[model samples]
Target: MRHLFFALAPDAALRDAIANDAARLHLAWGGRATKPAKLHMTLRFLQGFTDPLPDDVVAAARAAGDAIASVPFAFELDRADRFGRRIGWLGCAVTPRPLQALHDALTESCRAHAVPMREEERFVPHVTILRDPKRAVPSAIAPLRWQVDGFVLMASAEGAYEVLGRWALRA
Candidate 1:
Protein backbone atom coordinates (compact mmCIF):
# COMPACT_ATOMS: atom_id res chain seq x y z
CA MET A 1 0.00 0.00 0.00
CA ARG A 2 1.17 3.53 -0.71
CA HIS A 3 0.39 6.69 1.17
CA LEU A 4 -0.63 9.48 -1.14
CA PHE A 5 -1.51 13.17 -0.84
CA PHE A 6 -1.55 16.57 -2.48
CA ALA A 7 0.57 19.44 -1.19
CA LEU A 8 2.24 22.77 -1.86
CA ALA A 9 5.98 22.94 -1.41
CA PRO A 10 7.91 26.07 -0.82
CA ASP A 11 9.99 27.47 -3.61
CA ALA A 12 13.76 27.67 -3.31
CA ALA A 13 13.96 31.15 -1.82
CA LEU A 14 11.16 30.59 0.62
CA ARG A 15 12.60 27.22 1.47
CA ASP A 16 15.88 28.80 2.41
CA ALA A 17 14.11 31.25 4.68
CA ILE A 18 12.16 28.45 6.27
CA ALA A 19 15.37 26.48 6.76
CA ASN A 20 16.99 29.36 8.59
CA ASP A 21 13.97 29.84 10.79
CA ALA A 22 13.78 26.14 11.50
CA ALA A 23 17.43 26.08 12.51
CA ARG A 24 16.98 28.98 14.90
CA LEU A 25 13.88 27.40 16.38
CA HIS A 26 15.70 24.11 16.79
CA LEU A 27 18.46 25.79 18.72
CA ALA A 28 16.06 27.56 21.05
CA TRP A 29 14.00 24.40 21.66
CA GLY A 30 17.08 22.13 21.76
CA GLY A 31 15.77 20.07 18.87
CA ARG A 32 17.05 19.21 15.42
CA ALA A 33 15.94 21.20 12.40
CA THR A 34 13.50 19.81 9.92
CA LYS A 35 14.94 18.54 6.67
CA PRO A 36 14.88 21.31 4.11
CA ALA A 37 13.49 19.07 1.42
CA LYS A 38 10.57 17.80 3.48
CA LEU A 39 8.89 21.11 4.16
CA HIS A 40 5.42 21.30 2.66
CA MET A 41 1.80 21.99 3.51
CA THR A 42 -0.27 18.92 2.81
CA LEU A 43 -3.61 19.75 1.28
CA ARG A 44 -4.98 16.29 1.95
CA PHE A 45 -3.93 12.76 2.67
CA LEU A 46 -5.47 10.00 0.51
CA GLN A 47 -4.82 6.94 2.54
CA GLY A 48 -5.22 3.15 2.75
CA PHE A 49 -4.66 1.76 -0.68
CA THR A 50 -3.51 -1.78 -1.23
CA ASP A 51 -1.91 -1.26 -4.63
CA PRO A 52 -1.11 1.28 -7.25
CA LEU A 53 -3.75 3.96 -7.89
CA PRO A 54 -6.61 2.80 -10.04
CA ASP A 55 -7.46 4.58 -13.28
CA ASP A 56 -10.67 5.84 -11.73
CA VAL A 57 -8.71 7.41 -8.91
CA VAL A 58 -6.50 9.31 -11.31
CA ALA A 59 -9.53 10.51 -13.23
CA ALA A 60 -11.17 11.62 -10.04
CA ALA A 61 -8.10 13.58 -9.03
CA ARG A 62 -8.02 15.22 -12.45
CA ALA A 63 -11.65 16.21 -12.15
CA ALA A 64 -11.03 17.56 -8.70
CA GLY A 65 -8.13 19.58 -10.01
CA ASP A 66 -10.30 20.98 -12.75
CA ALA A 67 -12.73 22.20 -10.15
CA ILE A 68 -10.09 24.19 -8.35
CA ALA A 69 -8.84 27.47 -9.77
CA SER A 70 -5.73 29.21 -8.64
CA VAL A 71 -6.06 31.38 -5.59
CA PRO A 72 -3.73 33.42 -3.41
CA PHE A 73 -3.22 32.52 0.21
CA ALA A 74 -1.10 33.86 3.02
CA PHE A 75 0.21 31.79 5.91
CA GLU A 76 1.19 33.12 9.30
CA LEU A 77 3.09 31.35 12.05
CA ASP A 78 1.22 31.92 15.28
CA ARG A 79 2.49 29.51 17.92
CA ALA A 80 3.62 25.98 18.64
CA ASP A 81 1.39 22.93 19.04
CA ARG A 82 1.93 19.25 19.76
CA PHE A 83 -0.13 16.31 18.63
CA GLY A 84 -0.26 13.53 21.19
CA ARG A 85 3.07 11.64 21.07
CA ARG A 86 3.61 12.08 17.37
CA ILE A 87 4.43 15.57 16.21
CA GLY A 88 5.26 19.11 17.19
CA TRP A 89 4.29 21.67 14.56
CA LEU A 90 4.23 25.35 13.94
CA GLY A 91 0.66 26.56 13.90
CA CYS A 92 -0.43 28.34 10.74
CA ALA A 93 -3.20 30.87 10.32
CA VAL A 94 -4.48 31.39 6.83
CA THR A 95 -7.63 31.86 4.84
CA PRO A 96 -8.88 28.30 4.75
CA ARG A 97 -11.99 28.54 2.64
CA PRO A 98 -10.23 27.85 -0.65
CA LEU A 99 -8.40 24.86 0.77
CA GLN A 100 -11.64 23.56 2.29
CA ALA A 101 -13.46 23.85 -0.99
CA LEU A 102 -10.70 22.00 -2.81
CA HIS A 103 -10.75 19.23 -0.22
CA ASP A 104 -14.52 18.88 -0.50
CA ALA A 105 -14.32 18.55 -4.25
CA LEU A 106 -11.55 15.98 -4.03
CA THR A 107 -13.42 13.98 -1.40
CA GLU A 108 -16.53 13.92 -3.50
CA SER A 109 -14.59 12.72 -6.52
CA CYS A 110 -12.94 9.91 -4.56
CA ARG A 111 -16.29 8.82 -3.19
CA ALA A 112 -17.83 8.67 -6.63
CA HIS A 113 -15.24 6.06 -7.55
CA ALA A 114 -16.04 4.06 -4.41
CA VAL A 115 -12.61 4.71 -2.98
CA PRO A 116 -13.03 4.37 0.75
CA MET A 117 -11.65 7.35 2.54
CA ARG A 118 -9.31 6.98 5.47
CA GLU A 119 -10.84 6.90 8.90
CA GLU A 120 -9.08 9.73 10.66
CA GLU A 121 -9.71 13.01 12.32
CA ARG A 122 -10.88 15.90 10.19
CA PHE A 123 -8.22 17.69 8.18
CA VAL A 124 -6.56 20.63 9.82
CA PRO A 125 -3.92 21.99 7.47
CA HIS A 126 -0.47 22.41 9.02
CA VAL A 127 3.27 22.30 8.28
CA THR A 128 5.14 20.06 10.69
CA ILE A 129 8.48 21.01 12.20
CA LEU A 130 9.38 18.06 14.35
CA ARG A 131 8.15 14.53 14.94
CA ASP A 132 8.38 12.14 17.90
CA PRO A 133 10.23 12.70 21.18
CA LYS A 134 10.44 16.08 22.87
CA ARG A 135 11.26 19.06 20.64
CA ALA A 136 11.48 22.71 21.44
CA VAL A 137 9.12 25.06 19.70
CA PRO A 138 10.81 28.29 18.87
CA SER A 139 9.27 31.46 20.18
CA ALA A 140 9.16 32.66 16.56
CA ILE A 141 9.31 30.84 13.29
CA ALA A 142 9.33 32.33 9.83
CA PRO A 143 5.97 33.39 8.46
CA LEU A 144 5.25 32.19 4.95
CA ARG A 145 2.96 33.90 2.47
CA TRP A 146 2.63 32.32 -0.95
CA GLN A 147 0.16 31.43 -3.64
CA VAL A 148 -1.02 27.91 -4.25
CA ASP A 149 -1.33 27.59 -7.99
CA GLY A 150 -1.82 23.86 -8.04
CA PHE A 151 -1.63 20.55 -6.24
CA VAL A 152 0.34 17.39 -6.84
CA LEU A 153 -0.28 13.70 -6.32
CA MET A 154 2.65 12.17 -4.41
CA ALA A 155 3.50 8.63 -3.37
CA SER A 156 5.55 7.69 -0.33
CA ALA A 157 7.70 4.60 -0.04
CA GLU A 158 10.42 3.79 2.44
CA GLY A 159 10.03 7.20 4.06
CA ALA A 160 10.70 9.05 0.82
CA TYR A 161 8.04 10.63 -1.36
CA GLU A 162 8.07 10.96 -5.12
CA VAL A 163 5.85 13.19 -7.16
CA LEU A 164 3.45 11.11 -9.22
CA GLY A 165 1.68 13.88 -11.05
CA ARG A 166 0.87 17.54 -10.65
CA TRP A 167 -2.53 19.04 -11.35
CA ALA A 168 -2.64 22.69 -12.12
CA LEU A 169 -5.60 24.66 -10.89
CA ARG A 170 -8.11 25.63 -13.54
CA ALA A 171 -8.16 29.30 -14.40
Candidate 2:
Protein backbone atom coordinates (compact mmCIF):
# COMPACT_ATOMS: atom_id res chain seq x y z
CA MET A 1 0.00 0.00 0.00
CA ARG A 2 1.40 3.38 -1.09
CA HIS A 3 0.10 6.86 -1.76
CA LEU A 4 -0.10 7.04 -5.50
CA PHE A 5 -1.26 9.24 -8.39
CA PHE A 6 -0.78 9.66 -12.11
CA ALA A 7 1.36 12.51 -13.50
CA LEU A 8 2.72 13.98 -16.70
CA ALA A 9 6.47 14.18 -16.23
CA PRO A 10 8.51 16.47 -18.43
CA ASP A 11 11.46 15.13 -20.38
CA ALA A 12 14.98 16.33 -19.76
CA ALA A 13 14.64 19.34 -22.02
CA LEU A 14 11.31 20.39 -20.59
CA ARG A 15 12.54 19.93 -17.06
CA ASP A 16 15.40 22.23 -17.84
CA ALA A 17 13.02 24.83 -19.16
CA ILE A 18 10.78 24.53 -16.13
CA ALA A 19 13.77 24.82 -13.84
CA ASN A 20 14.79 28.01 -15.55
CA ASP A 21 11.25 29.30 -15.30
CA ALA A 22 11.09 28.33 -11.67
CA ALA A 23 14.25 30.26 -10.94
CA ARG A 24 12.93 33.40 -12.62
CA LEU A 25 9.47 33.02 -11.12
CA HIS A 26 10.96 32.56 -7.68
CA LEU A 27 12.99 35.71 -8.04
CA ALA A 28 10.00 37.77 -9.14
CA TRP A 29 7.35 36.14 -6.93
CA GLY A 30 9.55 35.35 -3.91
CA GLY A 31 9.08 31.67 -2.91
CA ARG A 32 11.55 28.85 -2.76
CA ALA A 33 11.84 27.21 -6.15
CA THR A 34 10.95 23.58 -6.53
CA LYS A 35 13.91 21.44 -7.44
CA PRO A 36 14.41 20.57 -11.08
CA ALA A 37 14.02 16.83 -10.45
CA LYS A 38 10.77 17.44 -8.61
CA LEU A 39 9.04 19.50 -11.30
CA HIS A 40 6.09 17.71 -12.94
CA MET A 41 2.46 18.21 -13.91
CA THR A 42 0.05 16.05 -11.99
CA LEU A 43 -2.68 14.44 -14.10
CA ARG A 44 -4.76 12.64 -11.47
CA PHE A 45 -4.10 12.41 -7.76
CA LEU A 46 -5.61 9.18 -6.32
CA GLN A 47 -7.02 9.45 -2.86
CA GLY A 48 -7.46 6.58 -0.46
CA PHE A 49 -7.79 9.14 2.37
CA THR A 50 -4.50 7.92 3.75
CA ASP A 51 -0.81 7.72 2.98
CA PRO A 52 -0.88 4.00 2.23
CA LEU A 53 -3.89 2.43 0.55
CA PRO A 54 -5.14 -1.14 0.28
CA ASP A 55 -3.79 -3.58 -2.27
CA ASP A 56 -7.20 -3.84 -3.91
CA VAL A 57 -7.23 -0.07 -4.35
CA VAL A 58 -3.75 -0.08 -5.80
CA ALA A 59 -4.75 -2.80 -8.23
CA ALA A 60 -7.78 -0.84 -9.26
CA ALA A 61 -5.65 2.24 -9.89
CA ARG A 62 -3.22 0.23 -11.97
CA ALA A 63 -6.02 -1.26 -14.00
CA ALA A 64 -7.30 2.25 -14.58
CA GLY A 65 -3.89 3.24 -15.87
CA ASP A 66 -4.01 0.30 -18.26
CA ALA A 67 -7.18 1.75 -19.76
CA ILE A 68 -5.77 5.07 -20.92
CA ALA A 69 -5.76 5.69 -24.68
CA SER A 70 -4.91 9.36 -25.08
CA VAL A 71 -2.79 10.76 -27.87
CA PRO A 72 0.15 13.10 -27.61
CA PHE A 73 -0.47 16.82 -27.30
CA ALA A 74 1.28 20.17 -26.86
CA PHE A 75 0.55 22.73 -24.19
CA GLU A 76 2.18 25.92 -22.99
CA LEU A 77 2.76 27.30 -19.51
CA ASP A 78 2.59 31.07 -19.65
CA ARG A 79 1.21 32.32 -16.37
CA ALA A 80 2.11 32.40 -12.69
CA ASP A 81 -0.08 32.76 -9.64
CA ARG A 82 -0.69 31.64 -6.06
CA PHE A 83 -3.18 29.12 -4.76
CA GLY A 84 -3.33 31.22 -1.65
CA ARG A 85 -0.56 33.18 0.05
CA ARG A 86 1.88 30.32 0.33
CA ILE A 87 1.90 28.37 -2.90
CA GLY A 88 3.03 29.78 -6.21
CA TRP A 89 2.35 27.93 -9.47
CA LEU A 90 2.82 28.01 -13.23
CA GLY A 91 -0.13 27.09 -15.44
CA CYS A 92 -1.02 26.93 -19.09
CA ALA A 93 -2.66 29.90 -20.76
CA VAL A 94 -5.19 27.44 -22.23
CA THR A 95 -5.92 23.84 -21.45
CA PRO A 96 -4.89 21.65 -24.33
CA ARG A 97 -7.67 19.47 -25.79
CA PRO A 98 -5.59 16.32 -25.78
CA LEU A 99 -4.52 16.98 -22.20
CA GLN A 100 -8.13 17.35 -21.16
CA ALA A 101 -9.04 14.19 -23.04
CA LEU A 102 -6.30 12.30 -21.28
CA HIS A 103 -7.48 13.56 -17.90
CA ASP A 104 -11.11 12.77 -18.68
CA ALA A 105 -10.21 9.28 -19.83
CA LEU A 106 -8.24 8.70 -16.64
CA THR A 107 -11.13 9.95 -14.53
CA GLU A 108 -13.60 7.66 -16.29
CA SER A 109 -11.32 4.65 -16.09
CA CYS A 110 -10.58 5.23 -12.42
CA ARG A 111 -14.26 5.61 -11.66
CA ALA A 112 -15.01 2.32 -13.41
CA HIS A 113 -12.33 0.60 -11.32
CA ALA A 114 -13.66 1.88 -7.97
CA VAL A 115 -10.81 4.30 -7.49
CA PRO A 116 -12.24 7.22 -5.58
CA MET A 117 -11.48 10.64 -7.03
CA ARG A 118 -12.62 13.10 -4.42
CA GLU A 119 -10.76 15.99 -6.07
CA GLU A 120 -11.77 15.39 -9.66
CA GLU A 121 -14.47 18.01 -9.53
CA ARG A 122 -11.90 20.83 -9.45
CA PHE A 123 -9.25 19.73 -11.87
CA VAL A 124 -6.87 22.49 -12.91
CA PRO A 125 -3.72 21.61 -14.78
CA HIS A 126 -0.80 23.43 -13.18
CA VAL A 127 2.68 22.86 -11.87
CA THR A 128 3.80 24.14 -8.48
CA ILE A 129 6.98 26.09 -9.02
CA LEU A 130 7.41 27.97 -5.76
CA ARG A 131 6.45 27.61 -2.15
CA ASP A 132 5.83 30.21 0.56
CA PRO A 133 6.28 33.13 -1.75
CA LYS A 134 6.64 36.64 -0.35
CA ARG A 135 4.60 38.43 -3.00
CA ALA A 136 2.26 36.70 -5.42
CA VAL A 137 0.12 38.68 -7.77
CA PRO A 138 -1.14 37.04 -10.95
CA SER A 139 1.66 37.61 -13.42
CA ALA A 140 2.34 36.56 -16.98
CA ILE A 141 5.52 34.86 -18.10
CA ALA A 142 6.93 34.09 -21.50
CA PRO A 143 5.24 31.03 -22.92
CA LEU A 144 7.05 27.72 -22.49
CA ARG A 145 5.79 24.97 -24.76
CA TRP A 146 5.69 21.42 -23.44
CA GLN A 147 5.26 18.50 -25.80
CA VAL A 148 3.60 15.79 -23.77
CA ASP A 149 4.22 12.28 -25.01
CA GLY A 150 3.17 10.13 -22.03
CA PHE A 151 2.06 10.00 -18.39
CA VAL A 152 2.98 7.86 -15.40
CA LEU A 153 1.78 6.46 -12.09
CA MET A 154 3.66 7.99 -9.16
CA ALA A 155 4.01 7.09 -5.50
CA SER A 156 4.89 9.69 -2.91
CA ALA A 157 5.57 9.21 0.72
CA GLU A 158 7.83 11.75 2.44
CA GLY A 159 7.43 14.65 0.06
CA ALA A 160 9.31 12.89 -2.73
CA TYR A 161 7.74 11.45 -5.87
CA GLU A 162 8.64 8.03 -7.22
CA VAL A 163 7.50 6.70 -10.58
CA LEU A 164 5.80 3.33 -10.36
CA GLY A 165 4.56 2.83 -13.90
CA ARG A 166 4.69 4.49 -17.31
CA TRP A 167 2.09 4.65 -20.10
CA ALA A 168 2.64 6.13 -23.52
CA LEU A 169 -0.05 8.32 -25.00
CA ARG A 170 -0.22 7.21 -28.61
CA ALA A 171 -2.25 8.07 -31.66
Candidate 3:
Protein backbone atom coordinates (compact mmCIF):
# COMPACT_ATOMS: atom_id res chain seq x y z
CA MET A 1 0.00 0.00 0.00
CA ARG A 2 1.02 3.60 -0.62
CA HIS A 3 0.70 6.58 1.66
CA LEU A 4 0.03 9.92 0.03
CA PHE A 5 -0.40 13.53 1.15
CA PHE A 6 -0.49 17.14 0.00
CA ALA A 7 1.95 19.70 1.40
CA LEU A 8 3.84 22.95 0.96
CA ALA A 9 7.60 22.86 0.59
CA PRO A 10 9.77 25.67 1.85
CA ASP A 11 12.11 27.25 -0.65
CA ALA A 12 15.85 27.04 -0.16
CA ALA A 13 16.20 30.33 1.72
CA LEU A 14 13.30 29.60 4.02
CA ARG A 15 14.52 26.06 4.58
CA ASP A 16 17.88 27.39 5.69
CA ALA A 17 16.26 29.90 7.99
CA ILE A 18 14.03 27.26 9.55
CA ALA A 19 17.00 24.94 10.03
CA ASN A 20 18.87 27.66 11.86
CA ASP A 21 15.87 28.25 14.06
CA ALA A 22 15.58 24.53 14.73
CA ALA A 23 19.24 24.42 15.68
CA ARG A 24 18.91 27.24 18.17
CA LEU A 25 15.76 25.75 19.59
CA HIS A 26 17.43 22.36 19.92
CA LEU A 27 20.38 23.88 21.77
CA ALA A 28 18.14 25.63 24.25
CA TRP A 29 15.75 22.74 24.82
CA GLY A 30 18.29 19.89 24.55
CA GLY A 31 16.34 18.11 21.81
CA ARG A 32 17.51 16.51 18.62
CA ALA A 33 17.39 18.93 15.69
CA THR A 34 15.30 18.19 12.62
CA LYS A 35 16.84 17.89 9.20
CA PRO A 36 15.93 20.69 6.82
CA ALA A 37 14.73 18.32 4.11
CA LYS A 38 11.67 17.09 6.01
CA LEU A 39 10.02 20.41 6.86
CA HIS A 40 6.51 20.72 5.36
CA MET A 41 2.88 21.11 6.50
CA THR A 42 0.64 18.26 5.35
CA LEU A 43 -2.81 18.98 3.94
CA ARG A 44 -4.08 15.40 3.92
CA PHE A 45 -2.93 11.86 4.35
CA LEU A 46 -4.47 9.32 1.86
CA GLN A 47 -3.42 6.01 3.18
CA GLY A 48 -3.54 2.41 1.83
CA PHE A 49 -3.60 2.77 -1.93
CA THR A 50 -2.77 -0.62 -3.38
CA ASP A 51 -0.98 0.62 -6.50
CA PRO A 52 0.30 3.77 -8.14
CA LEU A 53 -2.25 6.57 -8.27
CA PRO A 54 -4.52 6.46 -11.28
CA ASP A 55 -4.97 9.38 -13.68
CA ASP A 56 -8.18 10.45 -11.97
CA VAL A 57 -6.35 11.03 -8.73
CA VAL A 58 -3.86 13.31 -10.45
CA ALA A 59 -6.61 15.12 -12.28
CA ALA A 60 -8.54 15.63 -9.08
CA ALA A 61 -5.50 16.99 -7.32
CA ARG A 62 -4.86 19.28 -10.24
CA ALA A 63 -8.46 20.41 -10.23
CA ALA A 64 -8.26 21.15 -6.55
CA GLY A 65 -5.13 23.20 -7.14
CA ASP A 66 -6.71 25.05 -10.01
CA ALA A 67 -9.72 25.92 -7.88
CA ILE A 68 -7.66 27.59 -5.21
CA ALA A 69 -6.86 31.26 -5.64
CA SER A 70 -3.43 32.06 -4.37
CA VAL A 71 -3.52 33.88 -1.09
CA PRO A 72 -0.82 35.35 1.07
CA PHE A 73 -0.57 33.17 4.16
CA ALA A 74 2.25 32.94 6.62
CA PHE A 75 3.08 30.20 9.12
CA GLU A 76 4.98 31.04 12.27
CA LEU A 77 6.93 28.32 14.02
CA ASP A 78 5.84 27.96 17.64
CA ARG A 79 7.01 25.67 20.47
CA ALA A 80 7.55 21.92 20.35
CA ASP A 81 4.84 19.36 21.02
CA ARG A 82 4.31 15.60 20.76
CA PHE A 83 1.28 14.12 19.09
CA GLY A 84 -0.01 10.83 20.55
CA ARG A 85 2.79 8.33 21.15
CA ARG A 86 5.72 8.54 18.75
CA ILE A 87 5.48 11.70 16.64
CA GLY A 88 7.20 14.96 17.54
CA TRP A 89 6.68 18.22 15.68
CA LEU A 90 7.29 21.92 15.76
CA GLY A 91 4.04 23.72 16.43
CA CYS A 92 3.00 26.53 14.12
CA ALA A 93 0.82 29.50 14.97
CA VAL A 94 -1.36 29.79 11.90
CA THR A 95 -5.01 29.41 11.08
CA PRO A 96 -5.69 26.05 9.40
CA ARG A 97 -8.62 27.03 7.19
CA PRO A 98 -6.73 26.96 3.90
CA LEU A 99 -5.08 23.65 4.63
CA GLN A 100 -8.33 22.17 5.85
CA ALA A 101 -10.11 23.21 2.69
CA LEU A 102 -7.46 21.52 0.63
CA HIS A 103 -7.78 18.42 2.75
CA ASP A 104 -11.55 18.28 2.36
CA ALA A 105 -11.33 18.73 -1.38
CA LEU A 106 -8.73 16.01 -1.71
CA THR A 107 -10.73 13.69 0.48
CA GLU A 108 -13.75 14.23 -1.71
CA SER A 109 -11.69 13.47 -4.78
CA CYS A 110 -10.45 10.23 -3.26
CA ARG A 111 -14.02 9.24 -2.46
CA ALA A 112 -15.05 10.02 -6.03
CA HIS A 113 -12.36 7.63 -7.24
CA ALA A 114 -13.72 4.87 -4.99
CA VAL A 115 -10.50 4.88 -3.04
CA PRO A 116 -10.90 3.87 0.55
CA MET A 117 -9.46 6.48 2.89
CA ARG A 118 -8.24 6.10 6.38
CA GLU A 119 -10.91 7.31 8.76
CA GLU A 120 -9.60 9.89 11.16
CA GLU A 121 -10.73 12.72 13.33
CA ARG A 122 -10.89 16.28 12.04
CA PHE A 123 -7.78 17.53 10.37
CA VAL A 124 -5.28 19.42 12.48
CA PRO A 125 -2.64 20.61 10.02
CA HIS A 126 0.95 20.38 11.23
CA VAL A 127 4.51 20.26 9.88
CA THR A 128 6.39 17.20 11.11
CA ILE A 129 9.77 17.87 12.69
CA LEU A 130 10.44 14.37 13.92
CA ARG A 131 8.78 11.01 13.56
CA ASP A 132 8.51 7.61 15.33
CA PRO A 133 9.99 6.85 18.78
CA LYS A 134 10.14 9.58 21.44
CA ARG A 135 12.16 12.75 21.15
CA ALA A 136 13.01 15.67 23.47
CA VAL A 137 11.11 18.93 23.30
CA PRO A 138 12.84 21.64 21.35
CA SER A 139 13.05 25.06 22.94
CA ALA A 140 10.94 27.93 21.78
CA ILE A 141 12.55 30.22 19.26
CA ALA A 142 11.38 33.45 17.75
CA PRO A 143 8.70 32.37 15.34
CA LEU A 144 9.81 32.08 11.71
CA ARG A 145 7.20 33.44 9.37
CA TRP A 146 6.89 31.88 5.86
CA GLN A 147 4.70 32.67 2.90
CA VAL A 148 3.09 29.73 1.10
CA ASP A 149 2.13 29.74 -2.57
CA GLY A 150 1.63 26.11 -3.50
CA PHE A 151 1.26 22.53 -2.32
CA VAL A 152 2.74 19.25 -3.51
CA LEU A 153 1.42 15.73 -3.99
CA MET A 154 3.72 13.14 -2.45
CA ALA A 155 3.90 9.35 -2.21
CA SER A 156 5.66 6.83 -0.05
CA ALA A 157 8.52 5.05 -1.85
CA GLU A 158 11.06 2.66 -0.40
CA GLY A 159 10.04 3.53 3.17
CA ALA A 160 10.45 7.28 2.61
CA TYR A 161 8.07 9.84 1.24
CA GLU A 162 8.94 11.33 -2.16
CA VAL A 163 7.41 14.24 -4.00
CA LEU A 164 5.31 13.22 -6.97
CA GLY A 165 4.18 16.61 -8.18
CA ARG A 166 3.73 20.19 -7.03
CA TRP A 167 0.62 22.21 -7.85
CA ALA A 168 0.80 25.97 -7.66
CA LEU A 169 -2.18 28.08 -6.69
CA ARG A 170 -3.84 30.05 -9.44
CA ALA A 171 -3.52 33.79 -9.18
Q: What TM-score fits each model?
A: 0.77, 0.91, 0.73
lDDT of 3 by residue, 8-96 (tens): 78888878876776665455444455568777777766655667766676566556545555554566766666676456666554555
Lowest-lDDT window of 10 residues in candidate 2?
47-56
Query: Of 1 and 3, which scores higher on TM-score?
Result: 1
**Candidate 2: residue 54 lDDT (0-100):** 68
Candidate 1 segments exceeding 4 Å error: 30-33, 50-63, 70-72, 133-142
Residue 40's lDDT within candidate 3 is: 74
lDDT of each: 0.64, 0.82, 0.65
lDDT: which is higher, 2 or 3?
2
The top-ranked prediction according to lDDT is 2
| Global local distance difference test of model 1 | 0.64
For model 2 the local lDDT of residue 149 reads 83
